[model samples]
Target: MAAFFKAVNAKIRSNPALSYLCSTHFWGPASNFGIPIAAVMDAQKSPELISGQMTFALTIYSATFMRYALAVTPKNYLLFLCHFINEGSQLTQGYRYLQWHHWGGREKAGVHGAVEEAKEKAAAVGDKIKEVASK
Candidate 1:
């Protein structure tokens, strides 16, 4: 069993790509990408669901790690990319939260406003039909 494992390791080491694939440098950032992916997906959800504290925390976290990714020995670009995406997503989420909570976006999108808007559109359409019939 040890011999088989050793042979596989030797094969992996023989290829530059395969060796990099087996390294933590590749897998660490690859797995960390899920956070950014999830953050991007969350952007589609209602801003009311966003937590201000958590969004702020993640923003700071991503920014810090982005700097670390650049400072590291190998300069992990994959990690930097992951954190860059996460930072953008978190900033977007934070903006949405502020807009919904403090900037009147929620009021404009509320159920009452939607119903009033629909009624106005229906009335306008009815008036247009009446005008066409009268002509």
Candidate 2:
């Protein structure tokens, strides 16, 4: 596995995008385990083709998002969908939010739509929580 990683790293260093990927992987443990953990939990929608259930993915997303929320705030649209979904809401009410939701699917069509739906949902939830958090 180490050798494989080295080979991949070497290949990536030779390329542009791949090199960036390797660098991030090598020095981006925070995002590696954090964003996915944060985003997944904070995620309102789930991708149909992913390996795990919607709930599982949400959990992963939450942690990852929380880990890098501050650094990625400017790019929140991509990382968390919105500022409303900052660490406070996602970490505090994550379980409550995830309790009843059960997204089920496994199709290629509407993949982008599904992700967008989930992001919208997450943003809405974040907004609601943000309102409460401010109060």
Candidate 3:
């Protein structure tokens, strides 16, 4: 099991997008699982507090996921689609928490905003490449 995970980690590390995706896939669910358990065990701790922390964590995960999604190519469309659906769900949930509950801080806005920025930059670069190729 250890060797299997080690090999997977090495493969993921070879690509920046894969590294981010794998890290989130591994740690996001792990932390999410523990957050509820910890909250339940600690009566004195507020559930809202736990939820707020989770939203913040999810925001980071969503941003990293966005970067990974943007880096994926058509050759990996199926794999990208699978991760997109999974990560997009998390992104939506995190955004809802911020919009409705206002539990998370402005950091969510900044990180979430990066997704749009990355998209714009990628489009511009693609356009430039096309223009150069045409010339």
Candidate 4:
């Protein structure tokens, strides 16, 4: 078993795409065990806790893809970028979700407020674009 994994690790390290797929090992545990557990323990009274449901869903997503992605052959390296982007976006969204839902530090409030304002402005810009497109 150790030999098998050793060979597998070598293969993974040799290919950029496989190296990216292997990163799911870190993300899987963060999504599954870290965020939801921390939220329950530390943010129990806070209304802005990261959704445990979403965290668990992403955990399952990462776990499922990690198995499938690692089996990808070198011939299909071109398609691997699509898979990497998909997983990268999932993890990025998870990070943003945690920041938006869980962070409440006093020092970061100014930056957080700016972010909220930016979101509102972006929505208005989107509405304007839609209105122009309709006309």
Candidate 5:
């Protein structure tokens, strides 16, 4: 098995393109790219389906891995690029989550909307008290 790998390695190293294709540097990032691709595809779906906690977690995960990719020996730019794209997608997902759950998106009044509604009622009551006092 060792001899087989040794022969294959030797043959691969002779061609720059094949050498790159065989290296961990190439394949590691290549595999990691699927994550960002999936996130991007998922973004097209409704924000109602997005979990705020999961989106926040993935955003942080991508940020941490992006730094790790750059800090590692040989500086895996492909991996960095993968995580960078993932980070963007995750951030966008986070925004969507906030919009849906807090900012009253999709015609559904959410937390922010509820708070605003409560504040308006309170102000109206306060105005009535001042009007009665003035009279």
Candidate 6:
């Protein structure tokens, strides 16, 4: 399926006519995949989206595509979160916390004020995001 999407995206990118079509309001192929991805992980079944393997699969796939990240990777954080109330996951808190490693982005460090700091022995960069977010 990823291969198919990649092919479709590539094809659209290659053709000027298709590019125009993709740029339209709601006729693009992205919506085509969005609806199904949502359905595969039916929201009504589990608050944590545990039944839908597609979300998990996409999380793992997206995370694996990124560089070394913390346990609470952006992919997992967004995907694992519940649409309504809080959700659940097979992933442990520790594992989820570790995905915050974040080796890629422009940031100098990962999670701040979290227990992962003690695990990594990082004391100085603890509040890296605080100043920025507070502003």
User: How far does residue 78 in candidate 3 sit from its true spot (Å)?
Assistant: 3.0
TM-score of 4: 0.32
lDDT of each: 0.95, 0.52, 0.56, 0.57, 0.89, 0.41
Error of 3 at 74 (Å): 8.4
Using lDDT as the measure, the top candidate is 1
Which is better, 1 or 4, measured by lDDT?
1
Higher-ranked by TM-score: 4 or 5: 5
TM-score of 3: 0.28
- Order of candidates by lDDT, top first? 1, 5, 4, 3, 2, 6
Superposed by TM-score, candidate 1 places the C-alpha of residue 121 at a distance from the truth, in angstroms, of 24
What lDDT score is found at residue 43 in candidate 1?
90
Predicted candidate 4 versus true structure: per-residue lDDT over 20-112, tens digit per residue: 666754454444444334443543343344565665575566555555656655333323333444455455555646666565442355656
- Model 4: how far residue 2 lies from native, Å: 51
Clashes in model 1: which pairs? Answer: none
- Candidate 4 local Cα displacement, residue 69, angstroms: 3.3
Q: List the residue pairs that clash in candidate 3.
A: none
Q: Report how far off residue 19 is in candidate 1 (Å).
A: 0.8
Q: Write the per-residue lDDT of candidate 3 for residues 12-130, one digit (tens) a residue.
A: 89998877666655455455444334333443433323354665675466456546655755233333444444455555554555554465543444754786899999999999999
What is the C-alpha RMSD, rounded to one decimal, of candidate 1?
Answer: 7.3
lDDT of 6: 0.41
Candidate 1 residue-wise lDDT, 35-62, digit = tens: 9999999999988899999999999999
lDDT of 2 by residue, 1-135 (tens): 999989977887899767654554334443544544555454555432233344355555655654565565343333443323444444434443333334322333455578889999999999999999999
Residue 72, model 4, lDDT: 55
**Model 4 off-target regions past 4 Å?**
1-52, 72-75, 105-135
**How high is each candidate's TM-score?**
0.76, 0.23, 0.28, 0.32, 0.72, 0.21
lDDT (tens digit, per residue) of candidate 5 on 89-118: 999989988888677785564545677889
